[model samples]
Target: MPFADSLSSRSPQIPCSRRQALFGAGAFLGLAACGQPHLDAGEGILRVIGPWDLGGFDPTKSGAMFSRLQIAETLIESDNAGTPLPGLATGWTTSPDGLVWTFRLRPAVLFHDGSTLNAAHTAWALRRAMEPPATLSLAPVADITSQGDDMVIIRLTKPFAPLLHLLSHTSTQIWAPAAFGPNGDVRNVIASGPYRLTRFEPPLRMDTAFFAGHRGGPRSVKGSAYMTVSRMETRTLIAEGRQADLIYSIDAPSARHILADSRNQIIAAQMPRTLILKVNSGNPKLADLRVRRAISLAIDRQGIASGILLDPSLAAGQLFPPMLQGWHDPDLPPLGRNVEQAGDLLSQAGWLREGDGIRRRDDQSLHITLKTYSDRAELPVLAAALQEQLRLVGIAVEVQINNSSDIPLSHRDKTVELALVARNYANFVDPTISVIQDFGRGGGDFGATGWVNRPVEQAIDDLLTHGDPDGRRRRGIAQVLQAELPVIPISWYMERVALSDRVAGGVSFDPYERTLRIADVRLAGGRS
Candidate 1:
């Protein structure tokens, strides 16, 4: 049978296991136990389960936990639409040339160590972030100095517009001076957010207590615990057993099963993340634009989104999702499946169909290796779907499931042929920052490998310095990417959260995945 015909006859099924079934059943029993719960506010501590683990104490390395738990603060904050908002710095101003920026610190703020947060501490943190092993140093910074006890001044080598957004990143999170050792290394995790670290377990668990001295006042919840559970089944069991108050990144099927129980609430929001196929444009066979477009045309994004993800709306029409204001162009041509068109494009690219239906040019077979990881549950499944879809178009794809680090490692070593990854565009509020980081000069590990578009690079440079809120320049960049197919976007992302009814107060979901909003949570039924 022809590959296309065989694939058409069979329906795509989401792979499941016995463990999933057992844990899914356990989730129902856990939900049932919540009905009789009347635990006092002091007796209950909010428990959180998520995939992110505490890598280390360095703000440049593992400060995401501190930021998410509100144990640290950055110089700037962002709104839902990626606009700059007030944070540790109440307000900021820039010089006419945009080279000099001044930030006014929030008054009377106390760190977890009881030291007042001042401009000197902030300047030291910024300087540390701009040093070795810290990714924040990639920003266009000239100098960081303190004006007084409550003000910080920054000088830029050039007019970098994403400076504020870069400051808002987790790596730039400010720490107390006491947190560092004599060598300027981060020896402790002292910070100035609403929560203070009380217990620290490297890479697995952390316990924190609400800080009374926080400038925002005490949080509604007295204390909280975070546990890193890599297995989806274990996380589901924890959520079902009511041992955990909140769980992040639940699978679509597990979410559906848990949502059947009224005691549990599933809060899902669209995030500015894209499931993309990172191609090695440097490869001999893939360097051709026709071959790249053909491979992209072979993907059934709608099928994968609707079948595996259980949400057809998640199908990506363009490189940028709708959440990214100006970058997502509605008028751009949408990516669609066309087997005949894919075959013709391959023929035009000099790929001849062989006896076994695999395409060949000269002695090289139309074969490629796809690298993906199992950390994100959907990725492997999506890789399988993509492999079969590409086979139908006479392109033989071998899917290699490996560690998440392998993708970037292979990219650096020039061993990556194709990689499937979830790229977060709003890491710094401004999508252009991530765009430049990924697609600029040498090409990012998660972006284009062997190709560079001068127009896209120039537009990104302009967007960073001049800003492009109107999106005219952003549209051109997107158009260039669409035409070049440096990275093929398959689906947008939906962040899933499971909250038990025992917890009250609202959870604010940041589309950027910056903060977890644990401070706002309180015991249900007004127990506080």
Candidate 2:
């Protein structure tokens, strides 16, 4: 009686319905349909390729693998277009007041271990994530109670417009209670995903198997094997040898070299991540608004973006990217390369050029340390470019490359002079939460100089806590943040994923990096 069986019984071998087929092919019918998919259970592993090693399987402590890797599924889900859809919850409805939400569970759906997925199980998972240790943001339920039979009602203290987006995130992923130990700690992951974890070795490889219990449409890749090759050269080698079905994280030159081979396919995606310079505006040396404006003017964003990143359009003029539609205002004044204006501003601010040609104030020379990291591969190069560009403006800067985590740690210690790091703004579908978390008073993990404008802060709070459609207050807040430039952007980054021409029917990229739906991805048999 379940929808899965109803759909399955009608056509077990077909992946799409007549409506879908018509939409895709415009009513054209094939002379002969494809045969039943022959999946060899022993060799049924679909090899997936990525960069990070599968170190942590637990979804709470480390969710990179759990969320990005799609090793688990959340109650509510999002389509490739980022539209809110259903996962474990077949359907949902809200009260007129919009404070309460009730979701209906899919019938007869079972976990990999053959346990039925019910309202009780779903509620338990939500409760666990809401507890102190996990502190998941999406678990906004003050209380959750099962409905008469198959439904679950969630009561929230307030209406959260982005709650559905939070549900699609990894922290809300559902897991069998038995997957954890008596201490309520996760030791393993027995989840309901397109792929299930079969073999895992810490900091190295993760091999996944197709879930036989999956009741979704036909998938091309029934199974997949994921392995991490850290060294860029090694990753290239793997792709060259066909040892890796797909390769990622290689530099521009390396990617170009790999793409030259006729046997491989290279895919480039505009990653919703921005490379920014974080400054401490509160520091007396940097407090003067003129100093901030002068430094912003001095940095040649176009030169750095093109010369160092090999992309001209990546040069940023504002804090947020064009892809972040709602918050980004195209009407703002353009930031361009202006060395003469920078020099004039510094001179007017009383920072005169001394005999040594370095700008000086009293006995102090204009020198500072710029901290960066080599992890992302391009940052150190950009840092070097920045060093040269800043020095040209009579500002002496020294560069240091450390671990990726050092940026935030240094910010907390107040030891960081200026930090150059990449931020992925697409983590949350709605940009408001990220903006608030980063720019609010005390600042969140990634912001610098504790940038706080009371008006901007209040505007964001109004949008998050209480704001209706056509919220001019939210727009005003974004405009203020843009004008102030809490975090100065150097360039917007694009992530590259290299795949062997053997794979087909896979979506290009999802900015959230959530799931790569491989069902339609089939191994190319030399030709389409």
Candidate 3:
């Protein structure tokens, strides 16, 4: 099937003490405008603006920033296709039984702190990542040890194929021993990457400079600056005014505006991300599979893709998008809109239409609260559209726009009825890593809540250990998700970025959005 058809077919309120710090001055301001040309060759600095802020220094919590800035390195990395590539580890080998893996470290690499990259440091970083709060520890890792000063060994409880891919994640980023405090806390973030962090202000701005001792040598750009801008309009303004050289997470409308301007360039690539509605199946009203399917059938994915997203081809028919080749099941029937069927299913599930048009079972009404945030720009708009669509089927939805943390907090407390989120399935190149986190035995914060299927869990485990070559087990998992409607797949996504013409060389967009490739970026013309 053609790629297009494949996709088409188918506030939380902190205390008073936190208020002053979060809303302080200089928090939302863009960097000072350079008096020189936008891209001064002599003073090579790439200014960037994005939706996410510098939450902290912990790789496990805020690794995306570190990874994107090239201020940190992971033992493994992934290519565009999600295949494992080399990073800190030059190469790796596994034993015959596949339980023990050995990685050969690259030589002569130096951390930003002037510490040499060695096996002991690599092992310490990996071990730290496997501790609590770091999801990497969730993997079947049994132990970690170093061989001499150049090799690191990882012993796994079983043969897990996604281990390498998991290492590529930001959580497993290697840091120097000095980066941690006496108690092993992440007091600093010194690492061996192309860039080194010079200044960091939590939740807002970060500054970095090219590392002289970097393995790839000094970058053409002497330094770079990153600022967190929550408003999409502000990001567009910076891109258009050339106040910033690069801007990420552009909405469809902003993308169109940027594309029309000659001074800016828009780069977009289909990503392995799916916009989904996480459902709490434990709710008495949502406990029935038929009711869940009714809600899924009520969604007009085609309309949302074409009308809201302005990209009809992005309509998702399954949980996994076409970008994830193996997990996307071409054989399954495409998800379609059927209002009559949906109403009938709800009726069969003990819902009766009242005079006000709202369905009800006994004295309870078919009312649900959907939690979403506005940072992404599209999410709140999508939530409004979803509210309208669900109302058509005798369902009344109350949309709550809150902090991104609220969704997970609600999920943990089992109070969330529905949540709209953009789930990235390519965090590890392999879908299994995200799959296990979101849909494993116990439901995940962004995954299912109060929904469990033993067979589905077993299938995911089988894929992790045996590898889904034919994708039979993968299809099975998708089938299970489709039938149960633990999460409703709304639309696939395309990552969009706006670049100023001042950037001489082109910037590479990682489908996973892991790296910004600032090192390769230089002034449009030669040195001034």
Lowest summed lDDT across 10 adjacent residues in model 3 is found at 2-11
Tens digits of per-residue lDDT, candidate 2, 1-528, equal: 001001111222213344543542331122113321111123435555566766575675566676555568888777544578888888999887768999898787767676777787788677777765453544356787787556878888777666677676677788876687888788778877766778787775566767777776455565666666555555555565565555666555556556555555556666667898888776655666666677888888988777666567788887777766666668877677788888888887778888767899887888888888766778888888888877777888889888878887877877777888888776766666667667877775577565668887777666765643774765576567556766778898766666655666434566677665555467665521
lDDT of 1 by residue, 259-359 (tens): 55456566777889999999999989899999999989999999999899988999998999998888899999998889999999999999989999999
Better of 1 and 2 by TM-score: 1
RMSD of 3: 6.1
For each candidate in turn, give its C-alpha RMSD to the true structure in angstroms. 6.2, 11.5, 6.1
lDDT, candidates in the order shown: 0.83, 0.68, 0.82
Q: What TM-score does structure 1 among the candidates reach?
A: 0.92
TM-score of each: 0.92, 0.86, 0.90
Pairs clashing within candidate 1: 30-240
**What are the clash counts of all predictions, listed in order?**
1, 6, 2
Candidate 2 lDDT (Cα, 0 to 1): 0.68
> Residue by residue across 1-528, what tens digits does model 3's lDDT show?
102111110001112234433342223332333232232223677788888778877898889899998899888888778888888899999999889999999888898889888998789888888887686776789999999999999999998878888888888899998999988788888998889998898787788888888868656677788878887776766666666777888777666655555545666667889999999999998999988889889999999999888788789998998878788988888888999999999999999899999999998999999999987889999999999999999999999999989989999999999999989887666788788888997789889999989998999888878888887898889988988889999999977777766676556767777888888776664321
Q: What TM-score does model 3 achieve against the real structure?
A: 0.90
**If the candidates were sorted by their lDDT against the true structure, best first, what order would they fall in?**
1, 3, 2
